[model samples]
Target: MSELYKKSLKQIRDLLANREVSVTEVVRACIERINTTNKQLNSLVYVAAEQALEQAEKMDKEGPQPDRALWGVPIAVKDCICTKDLPTTCCSRMLADFVPFYDAYVVERLKVNGAIVIGKTNMDEFAMGSSTESSYFGITKNPWNTKLIPGGSSGGSAVSVAAAQCFGALGTDTGGSVRQPASMCGCVGVKPTYGRVSRFGAIGFASSLDQVGLFASTTEDSAILLEAIAGLDERDSTCSTRPIEAYSQGLTGDLKGVKIGLPKEFWQAGGIASEVLGEAEKAIDAARALGAEIVDVDMPHIPLSVAAYYIIAPAEASTNLSKFDGARYGFRAEGVETLDELYEQSRTQGFGDEVKRRIMLGTYVLSSGYYDAYYKKASQVRRLIQQDYLAALQKCDLLLAPISPVTAWEIGKHSGDPLKNYLMDIFTVSLNLAGLPGVAIPAGLGVESGMPVGVQLLGRAFDEHNLLKAAHRLEQAIPSIGSPKL
Candidate 1:
């Protein structure tokens, strides 16, 4: 049999059932892979090798659990997701040394499904930046080209999967964090419909928009991981009580009658590259070959989504970050004479510039006189954006678009201009505001850049299963096009 690195969940489960390889060996192979590749990519922030082995020993000696698909499989997590034993830093100095007493609901679900937590990968500080440059820990370089960025927030998670540091990983998506980075690194990631996955214990960025996502090397791997972790939880008020389906079963379902719409406005955007446009056209052609009807759709209000997202996301961010004011939790000043000084000093010292900027912007937008002018208008615009998507869905089963205008860009290319970095998230944020599901899959390799370009598929609220199926079919239609330097 081939090494575990090349096998998917199906292969692993069969091996575990037959006892071809011990659970300990499977997890050990994962750890060894991390140790080998993480040095070059720096994707993993903390590796729980000992803990994984201990869990594996228990599973092997005792026996695998029944009905749990992920039993003994290895998984990594974005640093923003809290793990009982690991530090949930959000890649910020404020919580640099802080550890949570409990696990995030997603983490707990994965554990219950018998998955092994390999480690916590790096991310943007408080999930705030686009290029991962805003992370206090340091930026996660693109797996395709080390000089380029791996997108933001979930950057580390994408690189980890592409590097084969772990079989799969859990990431958070607010403004395309999961899908963008997954595209940048040539991996597959899905942002579930907002309330499909419980968010209890996940560090908040934008309360209404925040969601846990998944990263894997293939659609089947991603679906298997998502199946284990997705579902409603009473603990999270936002979690939906709807039944979760078998995400893996229909990923390869026939696309004969599937209707996928391509928004004309998305491709016509000024920033989209020619190679990217060609690749997306080819993906549509391949889907057509599979009998999917490609219809031209219009989302007239799509252009304004970025502006509205910037205002509302920051508004939510400001209020959420107010909890980290030095005295309550996280960092505290060493030499403060007064209580107010301690709160102000520690926060100012611990938070990175981008975080502080967003906080200030958020506070300003929601401020006394400015509230009606900026925040209120943005809220109205947010509604319009959601309506745009809702209306578009009436014409087609799902909408298709590009994840990013370009492939992985050089790390320092946009670092000098903070606004440039923020613009990178423009295409991704509106879906978060609407609480819709989006999936990123490798479509083709860029001709000029020789990197991967991702195609995004969006579905109606809570229609992740449909979204996954569309992306999975397109991915299979394309050949071995992605080649991230994992």
Candidate 2:
């Protein structure tokens, strides 16, 4: 990777602001790096080389302003987020020819702040799968070890940052999509509080669960990006009207007097690999050494999180995705005459297997006969899960846990059993269910594959400042793992 690609967004921004490097050089270097490595990693599905260059030249001609947070920085956005010109395929045939006429709120923020959108990264179809293999565009490979799978559905976004294809990227995290992929890729990924970031333009999988997430080289970079994109948007009713905090100012790395909650459920969860657990321990020890107090907290209802999440998310997904019927937009079956047949044939042909599976499961749960028994029950359980975290947080500032039970697994490791893939999400789905903020940072290398293992720091709703501060503190103690050689 070129040194230009290796630099953080902050570093790149500073260089561009000072005219130390032209915006054209920075963007062209990023595109060149993506071209060289993307064939192997399959991280980026689309590259708007001409448009990005055009923007770069425009930015170069107009001198950078001191007030813009991300002036002249190059960033990649996940394919699921709506981009005005770039094809937002979501790595699925369902939206193969789809292109939004306007940008997603986050994309609009990036552009207005002078950040260049190099391209759209790949992702699971409609953000439904834990591995990127479910995408119609083909699987995205782990940069650490090509044979291993990069966790999804934000796998491409993670790989783009890890491989230095872009300084940072935007991804949507419905469950652990952003954090899991960041963990496997050894980068920093953060999902803000549910309504903290506007969701106006992103293609929805599960409307209640989805949030625009940030992937960056460090927590501080994530904070900078988050600060720029997070705020009230009149377009999205779900977006919080609360005043946005200055998140970057909170990164003092002073853990003094901070209480870190260690949940019993996370550590005792079955199938948590020993190496990942050990890395979590090291992070706890590092926090303790920095004057933070570790407290034992109980979240008895956490085991029910995955069960509730699957029900709630899929149900929302079914409703949100219902608009894609042949009559509106996206793919439409050519030969179908009847409306029902067109809807059936288009969906059957447009969607991949994983997407269809979730849609069916969602449809079943929402069916009249089973609605109360399944979806209603799951909704009730979800409230309990949220309450569990609320109660636990009362005793501590934030919760600490392993991002995943294991490191990146080999491709096709759990392909035979869909339930096994769901099991992998046990640690992550709960946070989304609770509508809290969680940041995943690399703890260290694991014992088995020598790949990166990450730990999550989850905080209260709308309190991403605390999570980013704690994460940045822990990040300073751990050695930086450089970009993988392709």
Candidate 3:
């Protein structure tokens, strides 16, 4: 039954339905794996052992329902995404004891689709860092090599899926959080279009950029989950009223006549790692072999994405986090004389260094005197970047690039420089600004490190179907790309 952990959600459902393996055994296996490896990697912040076993016990007695797509598969939640009974801290002390009153929209959908909740995964504190090293809970090590860092801020969710602690996991992506970690961990992860999935209960980072993302071993699994979660939501005003597509329905489909765009600017770079670039080129060649028409395209303003993301993401974060001042909710300070003291002390005491740093940065950019110089300039750059993508899409069906410049770096290798770590996210952040759909599918493992390398496929806004179909085609072409070493 060791093969159980490597099977896709579709395959898992089939095995359980045929009574070849029980849901109880599946849940038990995942629990055992988590117990064995979690201490080494710190992938999971909380394990829902009792809840998982109870749910599995119930499923074991009841025969599988044909309509339930993920019936019996266990999945973990990124701590930032609210779960009904689990603490949603976003991996920081500021909200250490905070439990949600309601599940995030994606979590609720997962439960209704019959996926058992396994645990909550760790993340960078308030989703600020590219490496999980910024997490207050400590860095999440790469599954391939324990010394290397898993990419963040969705590091724990990616680690959980890669480690087989769960069949798949849910994460939130503001910039490269989900895609970058999935790339580093040798897993397939998807970041849906902005507002594709409702963000009702997720702790806000960047109001406009944050979107719920998912991790799996194959494009098929990611597509299945995307279908269930993507839809119009009354809870999120920013959520589009556009109809959600069947992201999995077109699998086993070839990319014949599909136009794939390779952004020329992405290749000519000082920030890119040579090995990562070579793997991406190999992936593109394989896709080309499968009847895809490759064209060189450009998103000129993409270079400014990093600066724009840092400004906008934090600007929104500062305001969203203002609610955590120990006044009415969340973690409160032990002793304070006045309301002002309570607010300051509670925040100062509860927040981690990274969280405080981002808050200060956010406040600085949004301050009256600096507002035009920082926030407004970032907004203008964001518009140009989105326009760049829109123009490129006019020339192609879908766009392709690397999710991250390099494979997982050694944990803490980037100790003193936040700018260096932030630059690793350069390639993935533009899509967030463009409000487009993107997926990071494992291309192959690195030569020396043998860590995973992923190529990102992006689609026009709300056009997830095109992205998934292309991903499914390329995944089949790639070899030994699924199943993390962990």
Candidate 4:
């Protein structure tokens, strides 16, 4: 097999721009890599080999287009993002055979910029679980150690980039889905500020929290991809009308005069693994050595993030998923005698255990008498968490924190305990709740587990340019975790 698939997205872009490698060769190399490794990793649920090759050959004949930023690049999309004529199952039996008739805003943007839709990747059912194990398609294995998990629900997207199955992949970050997986898989994952990226065709898990994110091997490559897809879209009313920044142009690799705040709430929180904390400390030291100022900032309400997020996210999920009844296009149950039976039976048979659990919890919270006590209280707490972030950002240009409390664990380590999985997202949920942009860059390998550890840089809403610039500079200062042996 060709080693072309091992190159970074930027490297491949340059190669294609210079006519050093044909688009056909690059796409073929990636397809071959996916075929060889996906059986073991289970990263991609669908591989569009024929369609991708056809598009690549057409692009090869047309030559590179200067106006298109991603000219000839091959990228993967998480299964939840709608792609015309492709399965957008969300990795649940509920949408098993359903294919979207239209492309998502990001997919349309990527195609316009010359990116090939390589395939659809596996994900947690309806983006509800912290681990990809909840997918009906089967769990995605960590590339570093097959027995361990790849943090999710965006595990497959992170694994695809880490294992070089594709140059870059798009994933959704709703309460840590993208960043946590990137941390475990040793990849750069970016979740733009909410409304910064259009959510037009992304299947809603939590309407208020979900935002499309991307994963790549390096921060610069992430910046490139972000610039290609971000901007206003009339199709999504919530998408910001603010001008998009030239994200890649901001990468000067200079952290001079940059102030990075370390939150006391995040660092002092108990239960953080020793090795993970050590790696994060090393990253702080690296930033200090690079002419950056480090300061301590306090965010008292941040500790309540996970609690607030679970309530608000699932409540929105309950409202959004009500459309999946058997009456519509998705998976419909057979042998249903009554309309009520069809609704109940189709849902019972379609959704997995985790999805059903969240739906019930969501319905309960949004119920008549409990609404004021549960969902309403959670909304108030969410506001306080957002206030904490806004106040902290005023003290520093950006905040630096650990992406997850621990490294990837054994596949079934928390199988029987769902709360254990929820608690692991303590560090990442705040970003989604606050609608802030964050970038998770590999810090180093854990001493005990030998798995990847990542540090996230959180910035104010709509400040992705500065966030990506800081992440790129800090990324250079830290030691590379290197590629997975897979």
RMSD of each: 1.3, 1.1, 1.3, 0.9
Tens-place lDDT digits, model 2, residues 395-454: 899999988899999899998688889989999999999889999999888877788899
Q: Which stretch of 10 consecutive residues in model 4 shows the poorest summed lDDT?
A: 246-255
For candidate 2, the 10 contiguous residues with the lowest summed lDDT are 477-486
Model 1 C-alpha lDDT per residue in residues 1-486, reported as the tens digit of each score: 445766666678678767888899899888888877787777888889999999999999988666788888889999999999788899999998988999999999999988899999888889987777777777787777888888878899998888877788999999999999888888899999989999998999999989999999888888888888888788999899899988888677667988888887787778888888877788888889989988988877778877888888889999999999888789997989998998899989999988999999999999999998989998888888888899889888998889888888887787667777777776788788789999898888888888888888899987877878888888888886644545
Query: Poorest 10 consecutive residues of model 1 by lDDT?
Result: 1-10
Pairs of colliding residues, candidate 2: none
lDDT (10s digit) by residue, model 4, range 350-407: 9999888888889999999999899999999988989999999998999999989999
Q: Tens digits of per-residue lDDT for model 3 on 1-486?
A: 775776767788789878889999899888989998999999998999998999999998997876877889899999999899788888888888888888988888888888898999989998888888877778888888898998998999898988888888999889988899999988888998888899988889988999999998788889888887777779999988888777889688678898999887787767677778878888999889999999999888888999999899889989988888987777789868999999999999888877787889999999999999999999999999999999999999998898888888887788778788778888989999998889999888877678889999999988888888889889888886555455
Assess every candidate by TM-score.
Answer: 0.97, 0.98, 0.97, 0.99
Regions of model 2 farther than 4 Å from truth: none
The regions of model 3 sitting more than 4 angstroms off are 1-3, 482-486
Count of backbone collisions in candidate 3: 0
Task: Tell me which of candidates 1 and 4 scores higher on lDDT.
Answer: 4
Between which residue pairs do clashes occur in model 4?
Answer: none
Comparing 3 and 4 on lDDT, the stronger one: 4
Q: Rank the candidates by lDDT, best first.
A: 4, 2, 3, 1
Per-residue error (Å), model 4, residue 250: 3.1
Q: Give all candidates' CA lDDT scores.
A: 0.86, 0.90, 0.87, 0.93
The TM-score obtained by model 2 is 0.98
